[model samples]
Target: MTNQLVPTSGSPERGIIVPVPHQRPEHFDAETQERLNRVDDAAFEAIAEGRPENTVTAYGQDWAAWEKFCAETSVPVLGVTPGTLVWFVEWLWEQPGKKAGTYTAPSTIARRVTGVTVSARVDHKVKLEEGVARPARARLTQLKNELAKTRETRGRGKAPALKIPHLQLISAALPDNLRGIRDRALMLIHFSIAGREHELAWLRNRHITRTDEGLVVDVAVSKNHPRIVGIPYGTRLATCPVRNWDAWKTAVEELTGEPVDPDEFAFRRIHAKGKSLMAGGITPEAVGDVITRCGEIAGLDIRLTGHSPRRGFATEAVKKGKEREAKRQGGWSKTSRAFEEYVEEAGIFEENALHGIGL
Candidate 1:
């Protein structure tokens, strides 16, 4: 008999229809079923642990976007074909994006295809044929090549590379206030740890380990990998991320007359004109906003994004001939084209062999 979906709760909304993976077909006995049930339980736990939270969110959003695409164009949600994937990529080119007058990015379009693929295999339990996806992948590759040749987006309103000097300038201009204290700490720790804004937002006092030399922060990178990032003591206490972090915590305790909870988020929403705190953690968007706000306060004319720190960290590492270490620290897989861009940015001019030979 085929393995059956068993309900754990009475209502459908309340944990009904749980999955049982790899249940044996010949396990008709009650004892065998119970043994398979234990195995299935472990399998479910592994499934949950396998994917990182950020990836989970992105994949969810990607699937939702696919559904939206299907709704708009009257395509079947699971009826994925090479033609349909190509159509989705073409449709994305017409949709509005964050960039003014631009459609979806090449990178985003590629990721959306991955979302549909995952949704088909996992949620719908249908493995897409290799033949069906290969053509679409080829088409996407061609499109990227075409765009590179055309240079349609050559430095037009593109956010500049956020280097160490830019951050130092922003740090120097931060106000000596509660909100500023939090912002400064946030930006510095974010860059030092080379984490995504979401990761930074999720950080709590519990992740911090203060030592005589510096601070050790346990950061959760993408794919749920945990890493220890060190922030050594700075020559100047005023600009030190560790000291600033401690000061912010101390200031919060003094203001509320209570020690910060280990489970509490490191960054929280500020109220009363940025002088007081609100409940719950600061959002991922707010983490990015702090960086942009700091830049604006420092009179920077360049645009900055939440992802700048991660890119900056990678580039800086590449500059120091530590590209592999940067890739590992930034949670980038060996085959990530996005991470390759950072490596290129760091070496494009610095590594040019014609630099001294030409002049």
Candidate 2:
């Protein structure tokens, strides 16, 4: 028999006819609909901001590189088969670096395939299969090993980790003035917290609390996540984070002739003449600038970045047998490879096999 359309309420003509699977539209109140719309906006925003901006931008560039390859090679952009993926990587490995004779760095090569896979799904709405992931990673590893043995390390690599001695030198080199006080507090607090640049940049006066021991800081452990960290009193008053912070706060109050509002920035830019404070807070990049200035003043050889304090904290903590505390304080996830690297650096000379044979 031929199939027939079924009518609602068993009426042949009154109700509309429907196919095999019938459906109906539903309505919600205006307030409920508005809330649903907000939920959608928030969900997407969260996904977008979930990763750090640099990672997102790097992946976007990686995807663009894949697109460029596909265009030149006449491969289908969406048709990312295992063979195509492997071919794309092989093609990437042959590309030139910024230098005349240098090839693409292994780190860049490592991220390309993963970036392409992510871009395929997130940008093009295609879910490439997982069939080639293992092979791709294996081949990438082999290429990295070969390149490591053959190539000279030429790039501006990881920033040197600052130590306590460097911190002391930086402190002494800063002038005996308002800006100097602010820089001192900033770097000391940064080290104390093992802070990310954005974390220090995000702080407000209210986030810091004065405790009997030291200051308790409320910080975002991740995007929109809050955690309280304790910064204890230091061995001496000169290099103490808490005392330095108090001095900075007092100086700012003295300059402005008004008490700092609870929501005001913990760190602010100073005037060039060193006479006044700027209206807005210093940025994340400014954190690095301050550290670099300090490094120059202290006459240190290694390049310093905002991340130096965090690196120092992790390395020193592991060196002192505070591995668990280091991870927790540094906000390093349990499986964080970067955190493990710091631990490795701290232990490279520990229980050395060649110690007994030393001169």
List TM-score per model, in order: 0.79, 0.70
TM-score (C-alpha) between model 2 and the true structure:
0.70
Backbone clashes under 3 angstroms, per model: 0, 0
Evaluated at residue 237, the lDDT of candidate 2 is 73
Q: What are the Cα lDDT values of the candidates?
A: 0.78, 0.80
Candidate 2: 10-residue stretch with minimal lDDT: 17-26
* lDDT (Cα, tens digit) per residue for candidate 1, span 213-316: 88888885444467877788766765678888888888889888999988888887889697789998887878888888888898887877787777787788
In candidate 2, the residue pairs with backbone N, CA or C atoms under 3 Å apart (3 or more residues apart, or in different chains) clash, namely: none
Off by over 4 Å in 1: 1-49, 154-159, 221-224, 321-328, 332-340, 348-359
Error at 133, model 1, angstroms: 3.1
Candidate 2 lDDT over residue span 106-217, tens digit each: 6777688878876676556564666655676677777767767986552335768988888888888888798899999999999988887878887899998999999998
Q: Who wins the TM-score comparison?
A: 1
Query: lDDT for model 1, on a 0 to 1 scale?
Result: 0.78
